[model samples]
Target: MNSFAKVITTLIGSFTLLIWVGKLDPAPYPLTYPSNFGNRISIPQNNPTTQAGVYLGRNLFYEPLLSANNKISCGSCHEQKRAFTDGKVFSSGVDGTLTSRNSMALVNLLWARRFFWDGRATGLEAQAAFPLSDPHEMGQALTVSAAKLRQSPKYPILFQKAFGDTAITVNRITMAISQFERTLISADSPYDRYLKNTYKPSPIELEGMRLFNTMPQPRKKIRGADCAHCHGGAKTYLELFHNNGLDEISTDKGIAAITGMDSDHGRFKIPTLRNIALTAPYMHDGRFNSLQQVLDHYSEHLKQKHLSPFLKGSSNKIGGTSLQLSAHEKKAVIAFLNMLTDTTFIHNPEFSNPNHP
Candidate 1:
């Protein structure tokens, strides 16, 4: 070919490339952290969140098309308004099928090492696939869902934007959804504000905080709620499993179901208390409808045999550790728990459902 012709062909190819780039609507969605969050966020190496990826994830999460019946989406159970929980004892699936356990809150999932009440799934990407095929949840196969997504005009573009290609797969779908979930970091509560010196806790709340952090020392008579032992405090909550004296004999078996170990019986993942006020109907089985009931479980009804060793009674052999909080103390604890509710998180427009289909 002549030099002039080659130069002309190159110019035409450059123009075509520019036009193609302009036609595509892929946008970068970088994850942002609040200054108050400190140095806590540790994104997984494989699924570092991108703006386009998160956008795709949010859409996929809300898309009911993933279900067999095209009637249930991840958002159906994990509603943002209720801090991503369906506010039911067990979340209903397609055709009114109910999940075995309560839908867990999706708040601050980035710090989570294990997913689900039983911790069946290890990574968030793996976790996203569970409900897609669960008989009681979305009730659809990921392969079938991936095929459907591939045929969708909207989803292909989303896939291309997020993953640098138009090819759709179950892994990509799970990764995208997981990326969106990773961005669901909740850290702007009143407790967070107090830490930053932007807000001051109420007197009762301060008292509640004191009790929550205080470890019970019977010798010194420092009777405390000791909630921070499990739930942690203003920062990100701990990700530990415990048999918090919920059952004398295990029916659900919780972690034991996964491990097939008698010692793990009745042990369940301890969820974050960041949005404790909003995520009611507490515990793995959703036995308690209110925070008061949860506190009561700790204070009065704590079981002895299978209780976590962290509890006061587990070591003393006096039975399970009971906070034995007074009515006023319980009220104070509830009040402090209310402060954990991050209004900003629940109402964030970015986290809400998209307007268009």
Candidate 2:
């Protein structure tokens, strides 16, 4: 290659590298998962549990210093009251720009294999960086975040205790925060009680549970609607990402967006039913405003060229063997779902922001 060509390539590479590492100069660039109870959380081995690390991490989670403007923290959107979700169709970013998808709840994130509606992030450690740099989200770059945290009076001691005097780094920060988040646990729901045999279920709830577990096929003896197939077993829920046929053609194209797999289009991770009543506006887009609407969606909205074939009826009905239940039956199912709500989890003081307290 000619010397001029080599020099041009070197300059371009340097510029790209600079852009990647560049912080906000207005200064210049930027800032910055899940817990137990259900199955969505998976605590990494590198950052194991410790009182000091968790304490520091929790402080960071609620601290607005992670963002460039010092106005937003992780808790700003993932409010504990709304089951760790913002209750909006899409999450608002740092500069008032909105993201394309709803902010996912941080419940039981330890069991989730992927993060986001599209499953874009492969790990909790890597996932922390996506929102911080998004101009719409935290509006700060990673390099900027390192410098800011390093200069912070509060974070250095945290870094030392958490990592034995490791430098303030993006990797260390993410790990620490993730360790703290993984401590958010909620396994005391009514469903959990039922599993533990500590509490008795109501009559209607019993029937609904039976129906949910072993309801018959709608038309013929093809098959019954098995809630356990996806949402199954003792946990009362599974953490699989599925299209579930929420839409015939989803523009968001959930898992497909990340993996570039055509079949995974419009698929999203299955949310646990724990506290289902409280976390309203269901689905990836928060389209269902009510639990009744969610039930109605399952009952009436399942359609061909849209829903998964697994849910289709023996007669190839639009919705999987339409439950076509009467209002009373619907009420029964709703009642059963309500049993999953745990007042203790909602009111838990440990999960709340210590700064606010």
User: C-alpha displacement of 144 in model 1, angstroms?
Assistant: 0.8
Q: Candidate 1: how large is its RMSD? A: 5.1
What TM-score quantifies how close candidate 1 is to the native fold?
0.89
lDDT of 2 by residue, 1-357 (tens): 999999999999999875543322121011011122334446666766666666667887887888889999888878888777788777777788887777777765555567776667877777888887788898888788888888887777667666667378888777767766666655677777887789899998876676567545645543233565677655555757877767788878877777787877787877777677777778888888898887776666664554555666522233435545556666777887787777776677867887897
Models 1 onward score TM values of 0.89, 0.82
Q: lDDT tens string, model 1, 50-132?
A: 87889889999999899989988999999898999988898887757778888899988877778888888888988999998
Global lDDT for candidate 2?
Answer: 0.70
lDDT of each: 0.83, 0.70
What lDDT is reached at residue 212 by model 1? 78
Q: RMSD to native for every prediction? A: 5.1, 14.2
Clashing pairs in 1: 29-51
Report the error of model 1 at residue 149, Å. 1.3
